[model samples]
Target chain A: MRKLGAITQRELLSLFCSPIAYIVIAGFWLVTGAITIWNADAFGPGKPATLRDIFMWTPFILTILVPAMSMRTLSEEYRSGTFETLMTAPVSDAQMVFGKYLASLIFYVIMLAGTLIYPLLMEVFGNPDWGEVLALYLGLVLLGIAFTAFSMFASSLTRDQAVAWILGAMPLMLLVLSVYSLVRRFEGWQREVVQQFNIMGRFGQFARGQVELDGVVFFLATAVLFLFLTVKVVESRRWR
Target chain B: MIEVRNLSKYFGKRCAVNGISFTVEPNTIVGFLGPNGAGKTTTIRILTGYMPPTSGTARVAGHDVVKESLAVRSVVGYLPEAVPLYPEMRVYEYLNFRGKLRGMDRPRREAAIARAVERCWLAEALTRPIGQLSRGYRQRVGLADALLHSPKVLILDEPTVGLDPTQVRETRALLRELAADHPILFSSHTLSEVEAICQRILIIHEGRIIASGTVDELKAQVGGQRRVIAELKGPQAEVTTAVQKLAGIVNVRATADGGWTRLDIAANNNAQNAVSELAAGRGWAVRELRQEVPSLEDFFVKAIVDARVRQAGAKEDRR
Candidate 1:
């Protein structure tokens, strides 16, 4: 537990001290704001505004940003040689993994926090459905957490940051790609599995205003599995 | 105290550390003297419990390294060859974080950080980012981090590799002070510095202990005899005749300079009395007569070269 706190503190300080967290949050705001303003016709017009515009764009946004934020989570340390020191320290591997995971999770949460102003503006003008708003935000956060886990896993796969970035980008691309009809090449239960496993399909119920435990479990399970794999890699390196 | 036996580490099929064995007593500063790619770093890593041995066993502070590793690691402070550090953190912050990781409490850990900063001369950079510091200061921060929990045993790998002369002297002073109460194992390729600081020398080559003993003891292994040079005012024939009459002189070689003869005498042989007697009996004025001393470098080269030859012989035998 104490080790977890140390890891968390180290990751948190690094995220804030560097421009990583601010750049992530600001990037979200600027991109979403520009799109919203331009589509709403900028200054004075029949701009049918909704809270969905801000969050409706995040899975697509985080498909890029989360990888950028998490590409260095374990990858940078491996490249910097701090990963070896981390394993040599008296802390357990589990504590180290949790520390890094939670740190990135918190940073992603801050990025999500930037979109709060979008909802605040929604409350002033239209009688936007608050439940759907809440559910959509929940889905974005869940997906982000799940995606961050894989990004971290990818980061752990290699010491080269560029290689880590490419590896981190693969899962999000595949997660989006496996849902397309090309997945039918499997031609059986695998096809049925792919159709249901679509991340966008998982978000459908939530965006339309319903709570889905299945998707939540999926994201949580993915995070645990990938982080566990990262820990195993560190352990094996020590043995070798 | 530390004990290692039949320790071998195989990375895939290639062995980084072949079977080896040794013991280190408490409060002794032992130097691992070896050249590059000689498995010095790999051996230190296993001793510190940072990595495990593939076969055989090791024990530190009465705990088995593979079985009771956490207990060993809790008391063993390590500074790897590369001096790993977090660049974004301040010197004090990195030390504090490392202290906590080694299980020190908040108050005590903070105090330990302060002491380490003072010991490593890092007070001025306590608040500055580690990346902003010079290479010397960065190495000091690495030392400070290693010293932070006050572990009973220290394992330092090439601690003074890239430091300028001044910083190296300061680091050596700090290490000398620490050696009073802590058992330290420092690895280095330079024999002279280790000879000055360490009480014992461990010469390794190709993942094996080539030789181990005090500097004098190791030097004595290869340096089995003493060489005496004498310059006398007499004919070369006369000088040679007088010296050969003395006992314990194994071989004599006369210089081309006409009046000088160099004598190789067996260990424990008294050559001065022989020369003085020769000078007294012959009435030849003696100018110079002394035994030449051998340095650690001479011993190190002899030991490592012998080990390499032996390893080659063993490999050929296997084939």
Candidate 2:
């Protein structure tokens, strides 16, 4: 546990020491804030403005931003040869993987914190459902966690951060790709399976203020599953 | 302190470390000598628990490398071939981070870091970012991190590859001092450096240990046929024939240089006495007669050539 904390702290220090973390976080807020303004202004006054624009657009924004944030988690270490020193240290494979994953998640939370202003604006200008607003934030957090896991797994696959960017974005791309024909082609429980498997589909429940256990389990399980694969991928490199 | 038995590592179809074995006793320094791609790094990786052996076992400080890897890692300090480090970290920060990973508490870690800094001569560079430091200072930082834990075994791969001559000398001296308390197994391609510091030398060829012994021991092993060069005032043909006819002489060649003839003789034993006696009997003026002994470089070359020949012979037998 102490080793994990140490690695996580070192990883966080490394991430923030460079400009990449700030660039990523600032880019996320600028994009999200701009989209919020455009969505609120472009709508007809005839339709009641809700916080829908901000909550609905977050997953898409995170799909691009999370990969950029997590690309250097493992890949940079491999390229710089520090991975050897890290692995040879007295830390377990799981500890190393978790430390890095947690650091990315912490950065994700900080970036996500910037979006709180949108929710505050929503409450100030009009009547909004507190439960619904809370659920939206939960959904965003869960989605970011799951995305962080996939990005970490992708970082484990290659030494080049650019390649990691492409690889890490693949899962989220496939998730978005499912909306077209991929979902329409399925039927019955298979259709339900695909729907729940879709990140946005599960998130839709939380957006509606219905925080079901099934939806929560889906997001948390996805995070755990990918984090587990990240550990396996790290261990397999030694054999290679 | 370290024992490897029949260790082998295969990468796809190529064998990187063939079944080879050696040991390092406590309070001793063993040098791993090999050409490029000779599996020195592979063997060290196995010993450090960075990579597992395909077939065999290595034990470090009484821990099986594969089974008790964490224990092995804790007890072994490894400096990889590339000197892996976090270039963005300050020297002291990196050391503290590594010490934390090794499970050292605050006071102990600070104490260890101080000792390592003083030992590695890194006091001035402690606050400097690693990326800004020169290659020599970066190497010292890597060494300091390795030595911070005071492990029982030190496995360094080409620790002095990029250092200047003076830095190399200082490192060699420090390693010799450290060996009084810790057993060290370092690999290097620099023959003279190995000869200068290591008490035991291991030469690996094609993933196998082809030669291992003390400097003089390897010299005597490969320097089987003693050689002697003599300058004499005698008939070239008669001098050559006379040297060949001398007891224990294996071969003889004579080179005439105007008023003097030089005889080169390969022999299994000292032929100096017999040659001088022959010169005295034949009334030839003997100007010089000196025995030639092979140096480490000569033995290293001869060992490599002999290994290749033996490999070729084995291949032919199989065919």
Candidate 3:
């Protein structure tokens, strides 16, 4: 456990010490803030007292932001040859993978936390639905966890950070964009099956203050699956 | 102590490390000498538990490298080639981080960091970011990191590769000091560096250990036929004939320099005394008579050449 903490701490230090983390956080905030304000009409006096727009647009922005943030997690290690020193340490592959994953997750959470001000402003100016706003934040957090895990898995697949970013972003973009279109094109059971895989659609339930067990389980399970695959990839490096 | 037996590693169809075996006993510094693609780094990686051997086994501090890799890694300190470090981290922070990864507690980590800093001459660079430091300082940081855990075995790959001469000398002295407690196995292509520091040398070639012995043992192995150079004031033909006829002289090449003849003799016995005796008997004035000593470089080249020759012969026989 201490070893795991050490690895996480080192990873966090590396992440924050460089300019990448700040740039990613800033970029996420700029895009999310601008879109939310545009949708909310610059949060004008007569606008609805809701942060739903911020929560809705976050996953879309995160598909790019999370990958940008997590791309260097493992790929940079490989390129710099620090992977040798890191893997040779007493930590297991699981510990190393989780350590890095946790660091990125923590950074993503910090970026998410920055948006709390929007809800606070809503609460101050008008009577916002506190429960719905909190639920949306929870959904966004879960979505961020899955996105970061998938990006880190992509990072594990290559030593090039740019390639890792593209590899991570492409699938997520396809999933986010294709599911909505597929939901419309299909009918009956076909639509139901596609809707089941619709990430944003499921997240809409959270926007309505519904924290269903299956939705929580789905996102958590996706995170775990990707993290496991990352561990396997890291272990396979020994064979190579 | 570290032990490897018939360990091999193959990357796809290419065997990076062939079936090779050697041990590093306590208090000894075994220099792993090889050319660029001679499998030294691969062998060190397997021994350090960074990778598992494709065949055979390696043990460090009595733990199997493949089965008990975490246990092996815990007791081994490895400095890889090129000394990869987190460029954004400060020197002290990096050491502390390594200590934490090694599972050392705060008090112990502090003490270890201080000891490593002092030993590696890193006091001045502790607060500086690693990227800002020079290559030599970065290497010292790496060495300090490897020492943070006070490991039972140290495996370093070209620890002094890019250091200046003074830094290299300091590193050698430090390694000598560390050898008092740890069994260090370091790899290098620089024969002179290995010759200066290592008590035992393992010369690898073409993914196999072609030779392994003490410096004197290797010299003796390749220096079986001695060389004697004699400068005598006599006719070249007469001097060559006289030296060739001597009891121990295997062959002699005579060259005329000014009015004197110089005989380069390859011999199996005391050609120096025999040549002097022959010169005195023939009334030839002897200006110089000396036997050349074989260096480690000579033994290294001879070992590689002999291995290649043996390999070629085996291939021919198979055909």
Reference contacts recovered by each candidate, as fractions? 0.60, 0.95, 0.91
lDDT of 1 by residue, B211-282 (tens): 899988876666677677777777877677667767877777766355544444343465777887788777
- lDDT for each candidate structure: 0.79, 0.89, 0.89
In order, what DockQ does each candidate have? 0.56, 0.74, 0.72
**CA lDDT for candidate 1:** 0.79
| CA lDDT, candidate 1, residue B275 | 81
- Candidate 1: chain B TM-score equals 0.88
Candidate closest to the true structure, highest DockQ:
2
lDDT: worst 10-residue window of model 1 chain B: B259-268
Best by TM-score: 3
Q: Per-residue lDDT for A72-142 in model 3, tens only?
A: 99999999999999989998899889988888988888998898888887888887888888888889889
Summarize candidate 3's per-residue lDDT along B1-319 as a digit string, tens digits.
7888998899999998889988888999999999899999989889888888989998888999999999999999899998999999999889988998888899999999999999999999989999999999999999998888889999899999989999999999999999999989999999999999999999999899999999988887887888999899988887788778789678888889998998889998768888888788889999999988889999988898899999999999999
* lDDT digits (tens) for residues A122-170 of candidate 1: 6676556788888888888788878888888888778876678778876
Q: What local lDDT does model 3 show for residue B38?
A: 94
Better of 1 and 3 by DockQ: 3
Query: B7-44, model 2: which lDDT tens digit per residue?
Result: 99999989999999998999899999999999999999
- For candidate 2, the lDDT comes to 0.89
